[model samples]
Target chain A: MSNATQPTAKPDERVKEISAFRNALIRPELGGIVGTVAVFTFFLLFAFDSGMFNSQGIMNWSVVSAQFMIIAVGACLLMIAGEFDLSVGSMIGFAGMMIAIFSVTYGWPVWAAIIVTFVLCTAIGALNGWIVIRTGLPSFIVTLAFLFILRGFTIFLPQVIERKTIIGGILDVAEGDWLAPVFGGTIFKGLFVWLGEAGLIATFERGTKQGQPVVDGIPMLIIWAIALIIFGHVLLTKTKFGNWIFAAGGDAEAARNSGVPVNRVKILMFMFTAFCATVFAVCQVMEFGSAGADRGLLKEFEAIIAVVIGGALLTGGYGSVLGAALGALIFGVVQQGLFFAGVESSLFRVFLGVILLGAVILNTYIRRIITGER
Target chain B: MTGNSKFHHGDPKGAVQPIIEMKNIEKHFGRVIALAGVSFDVKPGECHCLLGDNGAGKSTFIKTMSGVHQPTAGEIFFEGKPMHFDDPRDAISAGIATVHQHLAMIPLMSVSRNFFMGNEPTRKVAGISFFDKKRADEVTMEEMRKMGINLRGPDQAVGTLSGGERQTVAIARAVHFGAKILILDEPTSALGVRQTSNVLATIDRVRKQGIGVVFISHNVRHALAVGDRFTVLNRGQTLGTAARGEISPEELQDLMAGGQELAQLEGSLGGTV
Candidate 1:
């Protein structure tokens, strides 16, 4: 083996470069990147005439990916910190209901309702963290319990207080409010409209307006998702706290011995997950102009799958926010792509399962190489 | 190995006070007694071996000293000043660092990241302050080199390192953080002969830096090789503390019950081999 690769007789005196470029190419996110390309191409070939490649179609999937990523970013960070928050999906439903009932039924301003919802969600997240830490229970079980508790409350509260399963009037309550634009609705809507009007984008051949295209303004969810991903990426990779999160997840005892406040880091991670869920709830309420008790169902699973596909270990401590973002994108494209191709929507779960299995296996193989594990 | 002469290079000679002095320390784990009234002291710039067999309270004593558990009753003095540590961080802040057998370095993290860990360096990039990767890499390499560990890449994950190298990283990290007293828990138990020598050499280098070293081990030969002084423990009590030359390796083993156990095993075998 030693004789196979011979070195020069004399070492180079000047600075010599190693194959650093190759090393950079095989980063942990490479699996996600490769998987995304393969999936995108496969769909592109079969679904070409289905408008899946069109700008509107792309935007539709991107919006879906954004919604998934907002929570996935949080879930990814929490996973890196060695925990899970299954209640995030339930928190979404609960937060939406809180915002709706407070504003529409109690006559509270939309802004006040949003603030209260966030505070309540934050508290619920802390309780999840606290119970897990204090009682020394598995976060999976604790958050699973929280999942049911919050979901039950979301459904039960509307029946008891609002006397309704679904509450409307979210946009009506948000109307004429200063804070509405911040938490709800679109941005640069007029700009996109202007672009469409200027023939920069495809316009309708025949419609009520004659020229306006079906593609509307950029969704606020997409903007918030990108911003949150940046924040999560920095917080996971740039800060001292980020280092602590990795250490804590990799080995909690080792991290504690190293003087990392693991409990605090995990608790803060749980809070972030809840906060992301709340953001999703706000956007959904704004987008639909209505709130339902069953909103955000199975979102936690989507976020976890995205995080896992992004190359995070289900056991924790190894992942990237960018990878999770890519994972979300993959899920969104496949889910929407199949629909555009006229495939049955129920097959989406099967597709999700197959993709999750393949991504995880690929991720595991990549991780073995990165960790140099035999 | 037997005299003050072994400590010629920067070793605290003749008149230095003990870095840490534990007096009549006692610890209990609920219904079980892990350690019973034991006294230990480590002076600056010398390897003090804590010799014991399994369940001999060596681990418990180290934990108590390192602040993993509060002593049920005892007093600990740091540099002759009585101190109390509620957590490991307190002890660490007081310049005492413990390298447990399963060293504190996270295997998945890079050498530099593991080295900095909770005490990372930070700098601003595009007006956003973050952990300073450049500084961490530089210092980790420098400290490791000082310990005779020349790592080719600071970003290499620590899990890829051998046991002895991981121990070296832990020691280097402790030294980097300005630890005055180093507590190594069975540092060489799982290492091969070559790796054990590497660890011993690191201990020697650390001692030359004028830091107190507590070397916990069951191997008498290994301890006798570098230890300036040795303290023997048996069943949670101090058998005796001996300075180098005060006792031989064979004698230390006897005190740790190694001789008796060997004799019992020989009797059990009844001269079959």
Candidate 2:
């Protein structure tokens, strides 16, 4: 209470020097780092013979982690911006189906279909934002409505067009398309081919496709996930808009009072989330060469679980993309390692629930220590 | 009645026009009238104290001026131009800053982040402008030092600071953002004596910088101690305006506590005590 101006207002010299290591320990990603290491080590112990630690195994997990990371990073950002997009999972399915329908059945070019999908996804995101802001309703409720709406549309659209739940022929469309390589093709295909020829990689035998590596090249999904994480990190920590997200999430009224345009920040966050879902859909549709109404089912919960495990506060205003990236890694290990260890795959969901609850409790406890909040 | 005391009123040197002139400002929340026909103004380099008891429409008046609540009737003239803010953002853009009672600080954010909440310092690096953390910390520390708050570091969380220290940070942030008119609502109501004195001193410092200040308070002593001009509000209406040395603290208190009518009523009903 002694607010009286002191004679000297210099920084306290007797304050203990903050060592580099301690400062690093208090970073928001600490729990995610520990969780990743623990999960990896546990998998290493149980699945060593399964070769989950080998290059091929690592690549497998990386692909799986990449799939989750692409969505989780965006979800993490949205969570930090103080919102939830339950519809993201549904958006992926809807977008994938739309892209396939537009390109293959409707006779549109692959790139044009992608462009149309982008516009449609952006509009959906904007609508979510507008409704949430205009009605002053919680985004959870609003996006849930979108979830059912999009899921129903995804199911009904394919049924009406192709007379089935699945939309195929996208792979055929992708075969001759110029942009296919950018979205779904392997990056080191030529290098892997050379490696296979040099006997550095395992290859198929007694066939026209003999003497080729088991894994041809890095999947674009992995590349996209890494890129998204880096982009999300920079956008969250280094930009003015990043500051706005933290401020808006931390205290919306306070942020608005500071002239942050909280409404616009939130709307943009919703759009970015939808945009991420669309990206995931585009890559996945091309990767699998087919789109189904069931595609990306329960993906919203997985992404959110990944984010929460990454150390984001559910109440909002705090999170890290790196943590989310590591969380996705942990998730990938848990799922793939269980299969490798002969454990039931169904157990992974239960494990996800426990990890989420534990990580959140740990995150909240750590945050309290850092903030010294009672 | 402009009798025996010295009062600084109307105009001060070089303050040709009032920095903010609010006339007949009225705010109605649905059927309930929060503020009715309340007019107040603050001149440049002057500390205008708005005195009112709880439920005296003081909060509503503050909200109206600061753009939390738009006036249903009357007008606000900022820098001699009539202005109606769509919200607080427009009010802030027009160079008016409001520090609410809670101070509107994000507790979990770092001091530097809180200091530069809406408008952070950024510098272009690698074709992208970053938050400029180094500059932010340096400036946050420097601004706080000017306000006589010596912190260990700018990265320290704001919630860990004392109540008074947080108030100083809020004031420093307000000043740093180039606010021409500063409105503080119940700044010292929740503060201790020493904190109150600190805030009063900060107000003195702010006033010396030539920015007009509207300090809302019910405590006559505190208001008279720091205020250059005083406007007392009652029942969503203004009792009157006075100035330093023009009216004693006792007279101002009477006016703020409900003038002669309350005194006469108390006499007729006999003292409850």
TM-score to true structure, per model: 0.91, 0.91
- Interface RMSD, one decimal, each candidate: 7.8, 3.3
Cα error, residue A79 of model 1, in Å, equals: 1.1
lDDT of 2: 0.85
Q: How accurate is candidate 1 locally (lDDT)?
A: 0.84
Per-residue lDDT of candidate 2, residues B1-273 (tens digit): 334234332334534688888888888989988787887888888899999988999988888887778889998998889988887778888878888886778877789988988788899987878888889999998998888887767888787676877888898899888889899888888889877888888898898899999999988778987898898888898766776777877677667777676577657878431
Candidate 2 C-alpha error for residue A354, in Å? 1.5
Deviating ranges (above 4 Å) for candidate 1: A1-26, A204-213, B1-14, B28-36, B72-74, B125-128, B258-273
Tens digit of per-residue lDDT, candidate 2, span A2-90: 23556356654654566778767667798899998898788878789997876588788888989999999989999998889999999
